[model samples]
Target chain A: MKRLKKVGLIAVVCLSLVACQGGVPKEALELSPESLQQRQTQTRRFDTNNEAKLLTSGAQVLQDLGFTVEDSETKLGMIAASKDRDATETGQVVGAILLAILTKQAQAIDDKQKISVSLITRPISAKETLVRVTFQRVVWNTRGQVSKTEPLDDPKLYQDFFAKLSESVFLTANEI
Target chain B: MTNTVKKTACAALVVLLLAGCQTDSRDQVLATSESQVALRSIQSRVFDTTDKAKTQRTIIATLQDLGFVIDKADATLGTVSATKLNGYAMRMTVSVRDHGTKQTLVRASAQYNQTAIEDPLPYQQFFTALEKAMFLTAHDAD
Candidate 1:
């Protein structure tokens, strides 16, 4: 009876300490509204009336960028693609340590990361179409649990995508 | 006495560790009515062409060109939805209907991470870009 009472008391104290640790820190989970607004404003638009041609050109551009085209629908005017990135040495080591501490399952030196891209097309008129592209980076632990989901908001990245897309569109237009 | 204390400590640790694993769901804030009214005011555009299919196709193409992944498209209903994520997720849905035999109306709404984006600039920019694309598409048809 005494042992049970002592255990209960210890459990209560430890649980209280854990509770004080709290949930995932807000900073770690959410991006600031200012940054989100900046990102939204920074996203540029493209004008094209030929939905079919644009869809084809967009797929070609993504493929040229080394992204595997996962899905494409001309009628829907949407494409999904993903690229694989090899984790850096430091990342792997730190991931391993974190995994061992968190889930106790660590047995790999090579961790692979993935970046996904999604594109949507909207039409404003018979002669106009608007395109929006989004990029995301996902990191998974050896246990297959998602560790991080970061949005890629580099202006240069968007510029590069648009540049390639323009080239593809030109080629498609000229049939060259 | 020592054995009893050790057993008690182990039991306590187990219970505490299990309790620590509990997690809370993230909270989301609702948009104000003023923002909703403002968003509704600018979410629509009128196209010159009466061809609903062509207008719908152009909208889909424009979304694709902008790098949004199409989630759903319905021709009979004249509705399309596409989603994109850059840290935050945005879903844009467009609905097309005939205003007259020679004119079509397009309505679009954007949601950022499940919350309505009440800003008019993004919607205006999108419509402006769409207008340009429509011109290009018309040129191509010729």
Candidate 2:
């Protein structure tokens, strides 16, 4: 009976969450100053104008990162890839266990996460091509419910990805 | 068991009451307060250039600039789908086709989480951003 009440409470909380959500936020479609900064962070330019070559190298880098290609349009110079990885942390597990022991109820720990990436290449001119990549992730808890769905905006992540991509481009250019 | 059943029933009623019951949930599958033509006018625009490839690329760039991660894009079909996740998910699909010999039609439809975004103001904001990127005026597709 107590468990039933808990379920009801959870349902009510979820109902309130759904009810309170408004339409798309006002700034959702509008461009902001940070957009420029993010674009700079997510984009890099290569001296080679061969857009196809850049796309190929980008795919290779994603593969090296343990991501599986999901979609690509060579004509448009776009590639999408994703990887399913373990999201469990020892600290989170320990905390969950402690809370469960105190409350006599099991707490859901983070279990799995899927990180998705999109890569796009644009030609700036006859000699320059710009490659941009963005990443987002969906995390599920041990309960198999989505816990977090958000874009990954760590500048270092983008930097690391581009660094690998740059090396891949160089190696591919040299026929390595 | 009856006591538990009674409590469950009461809780379900509370859930319904808290939801406000503005619209019937069953009707959501095909429900639209706006007319089809009205929605079409709000979601579509015509550009003077017939360069579908360039227009699609510009749309991709605009979506990226608006903080969307591209999901899929098909040049042959002239469709690009992307999702923006900033605490919430906003999925948008932009399709480009020829309006005539000299004009290209670009239509974008977006859904915020589960609800379709039929609002005209948001669509206007989108076209404004897109036009700035394309360097072309967006003619209302009336």
Off by over 4 Å in 2: A1-21, A171-176, B1-31
Model 1 chain A scores worst on lDDT over the 10 consecutive residues at A21-30
Q: Is the docking of candidate 2 incorrect, acceptable, medium or high quality?
A: acceptable
Question: Residue A5's C-alpha lDDT in candidate 1?
Answer: 87
Give the candidate number with the greatest TM-score.
2
lDDT of 2: 0.88
lDDT of 1 by residue, B26-139 (tens): 323443534555555578777778777777777765664454555667777888777654445567899988776767788888776544655656676677667765883221
> How do the predictions measure up, each by TM-score?
0.48, 0.85
Runs off by more than 4 Å, candidate 1: A1-44, A89-110, A141-147, A171-176, B1-142
